[model samples]
Target: MAFSTPRVRAVRHALTAGLLAVAAGLSGMAQAQSSTPIKLLVGFPAGAGTDAIARMLGEKLKDELGTPIVVENRAGAGGQIAAQALKAAPADGHTLFLTHDHSISILPQVVKNPGFNPSNDFVPVAGFATFANVLAVSGATPAKTIDEYVKWVKTQRDGKDTIGVPAPGSIPEFLVKMIGDKYKLDLQAAPYRGSAPMTADMLGNQISAGIASVPDFIENHKAGKVRIVAVIGAKRQPLLPTIPTFSELGFPNLDDYPYYGVFAPVGTPQPVIDRFGTALQKVLAMPDIKQKLTTLGLNVAYEPQGQFAGRVRTYTQSWERIIQASGFVPK
Candidate 1:
């Protein structure tokens, strides 16, 4: 182990040179990543809940990322259009899709040619939150609980009791079917273009009941314009603790909550993925971000890349079975 002074100096010089080269490479990579503006694509209209969440995250992420983040809405086909656009975008870590479970997990099963497979076309950066669908009735309806609502529905003058759902083949629509089957009630799901119109119809008494996300009905529920009879989740939502969950109400099949996450194109670099995911975790951990999302009736659940990707796979499988069992025919 005896080495000459000259040999030791040579070894030290080589080590220093290698370390400097590595540091320079890393600096170059960081500069490249921050050189361009990040585009966060929302797969819904401007005023939709998903769009709001995307914009909120973009605002906070821009500060953490030290780069401009622009939110673009490409609304159509239940997020299929935006998913396809993300797939076509360059894998430079400059484009991301801020979407919910509908576009990522449910659409592939319901749409014959959705143009992109979430599990295959994109990589999960991070999952921000999860939200439950709610079953609510108009204030005019003389019912408060699910049991009472079932009775009132049976007594409707029309032979078919209609429940308005935000969209066709959505979780809310499937829940309407599951609830009807569980209680042996004659119920029909009336699919609307979106939650806003469905909620409007509910307020106008055009429909006896409506099924949408808690946020879709929270304000109206609080104002007494609508009554949230039950929420679709494992337990009662913290924002609406008074409303019972479907599991507690003897319907465990409706207890699944959908997720919201960020994704990038398939070939995005690992370093970029890590950087963005770390920034997202930091943003999700902020007190104000958590509070804001919670106030919107979302569970501030943050899952990193590995766990989020696994969740996406499991959710996809679950939805596949649920969609098939619901007898939904792809369009």
Candidate 2:
């Protein structure tokens, strides 16, 4: 059925107006995204290791993404605060969370309700590095090796067998329990607000030992203030070549390493994820940045979205089995 000439003209004009309006709306959205600063959330205090990494990445990412990057710290409950914040943010790619494995992979399984589900609330942007955790004995202790440390615990402290952990229900705390079970000692985990105080107590001999990331103890270990007896990884770490891995020492199941990655709110457009991830890939590839991160005890390896997601799944599953085997009911 042919319309009148006036009706046809009216339809053509309406279609043109609709197309122009849609184009204008898209252009406005593009302009807003280009001008808006991206907020990078970290669930740790300023000056913390995770905070440091976030700042470093933010510093370089601004140049690559062509927009200012702002790091926001929401310190509490072992990254639960920041994870919740990320969950609550709009899924418009303006907000991201930069964290290690604990927040995304472990916390939810341990906490009864952490207020955020990584798989449901966030999308993996990119993974920049992997790191190992170590068992470091305070300088006050005479033990330099894992065996010697066990002996010291069994003999030196008549009744005290406590290891300081950065946070309660953390991986280090679980490791403390595992070590106790293995050695048949009454080891207790003394939780601290963060690694700084935990290391201070270790330095002051208030705690016989502590378990934390390699970056947490590397400087002190190099200064002879603490002795790293064991690390958790498949093989020896390059930074501390002489330190034996738990796997090398006897525990083959403790070979998985934790990772550091960036995540955006779920439902972020694919172009946004791809752009941010591509920028991250370039940032991680810089020789100077790689050197700096390696110096901080990180094994720099850039994995894009798919590989990073797989890494997160594998690491999460490994720890899930370990946690379940430990008979730890989430609380």
Candidate 3:
């Protein structure tokens, strides 16, 4: 109470310096925590569907955060490379995996030792896209529909004709077997690394038919190189109004359309997860994103963490049955 003016000024200066130090430390911590650019790792090569979607979202994420977003293509092994990379990432939310059901749902069923656990090693970020696969035949083939395709295969298979699948135990392979079994075709199913390679074979006459996402063949099929035998969703894809759904052809249960989603490495903080989800929701709502996906035959859908987790669990159960029913085993 009786301090001199100089003493009081010295105390005030010390207090001010301490406050500034604390403020600076907190600001630096904030920047370190979540303000940096993020890497969106895609498990497919450029021009692939997953890569395209990741780039679209990465651009929006960059805009929304004022940070750069890089989409690194880590192709091969049906996403095992990307999945394993995600498994080893820092889980700091600055790196994420953008993948389809194959890596998340089918791989566990396909590989005996996949090297990563999707359920325990990753946190669901968002599920924002779904692709309805179709059974397609080469234009050189005489099939116009799934029924026609099966019947024609019986006519011309002549002991051996191939139905190209992205890979055995992949979602596309499952669809191929389902339709083949349903129609009693028993045609050979040939597996490839990804849809791109499979489509190459289908178009080059190396394979007579293929089970692939609608987007994969929409252009070539329209141009007369390939044709959709049947779509695997319950209803017709809005993008391809002319393509008939499996249900429309009396297999309503072929409604299991495949989806794509993002997941951060396990242990990423909850706040970071929230930031990603919010930015992604805005991206998904963009008019251009919706239009582009639809035009490519992907139906846009978004689910936040909780719903996406539920879907992961729900589809886990469903695909186990499908894989078993389809007589597929990891080998």
Candidate 4:
């Protein structure tokens, strides 16, 4: 195996140099990650709550990761489109998906043969924050608390119990179903394209009650146009201290609420995922960002990559039962 020929020696030297050059280039790129812009793909329209959070996190992630982060809206199918897009993209860490439980967990349970598999096709990067789903009654409604609302719902005529939820299989819809079942209340569930439409209908008295994420109605509730009777959380949101959560109402099993987080495509290097998660956790710890998210009534939930991945698995299983229990069908 000893090659003394000049030609063999020259070939070996060229191969070693080529490998060194490649290694050096990779190291230089990692050092210059600040100059490369990262993409954050959201599965909702611009101006939506998820989009807003994405923008906020992007602003902070850009500062921490030293890379300019850009948010791209790929809206449709309760975030399935964005999830699908992530699955189709290369497993590079450059493209990231900032989505919630709906896109990753709920949608797949309802849809038949969804193109993307959340747990298998993606890796959880960081979990940022969580907001409760507030049970809001339109101004025209004559009830304020869950007890009163339950009584009112029972009194409604067969067709008068229309409750406007964001979508048929969304988290909000599932909440309404869970509570309605617990209280033995009759409700006619109605679906909307998004929270904006449902909020509008609630104001117009088209739907007696609406269940949406607290961020969607926080402003209107503050203005007194809509009232938050109950929030689905372990405790009241700090901004809405007076509003009692379902657990406070004695529904201990209904305490934990939905969460949102960032995910990278599968096969992404563990180092990149760790770096991204660390930078995001730091971003969540910033005082200014914390104040801003708190103003939107969201609690900081900066779970690291491992724990966040574990929660995703638990949430997926829990909601599989809830979705099937609700009998929600995509088509």
Worst 10 residues of 2 by lDDT: 23-32
User: For model 3, how does the per-residue alpha-carbon lDDT over 58-177 read when each residue is reduced to its tens digit?
Assistant: 888788766678899999888889999999998777789998888988898889999999888999988987888888888668778766777677787753457888867787666665
Clashing residue pairs in candidate 3 (N, C-alpha, C atoms within 3 angstroms): none
Cα error, candidate 2, residue 154 (Å): 1.2
What are the models' TM-scores?
0.89, 0.91, 0.86, 0.87
Report, for every candidate in turn, its global Cα lDDT versus the true structure.
0.85, 0.90, 0.81, 0.81
Give the range of the ten consecutive residues with the poorest summed lDDT in model 4. Answer: 25-34
Measured by lDDT, the strongest candidate is 2
**Candidate 3 local accuracy as lDDT?**
0.81
Instruction: Please give the range of 10 consecutive residues that has the lowest summed lDDT in model 1.
Output: 24-33
lDDT score at residue 201, model 4, on the 0-100 scale: 89
TM-score of 1: 0.89
Q: Write candidate 1's Cα lDDT for 1-331 as tens digits.
A: 8766988899999999988767655743763556578999998889888888888889998988888999999988778899999999988788999998888888788778889987678999889888988899996688989888887766763435889988787888888888888888878899887788899999998888999888789888889899999988787889888888888988755556788899999977777788888889999999998898898899997898999988888878877887887778998
* Ranking of models by lDDT: 2, 1, 4, 3
Cα lDDT tens digits for candidate 4, 216-254: 999998998888999887777888889898888876456
In angstroms, how far off is 163's CA in candidate 4? 1.0
Write the number of the candidate with greater lDDT, choosing between 1 and 4. 1
Q: Model 2, 1-331: lDDT tens per residue?
A: 8667988899999999988767656643573468789999999999999999999989999998888999999999889999999999987788999999999999999999999899999999999999999999997789999999988877887635889999888899989988888778899999998898999999999888999999999999999999999999998999999999998877748988999999988977666777888889999988888899999999999999999999999999999998998898998
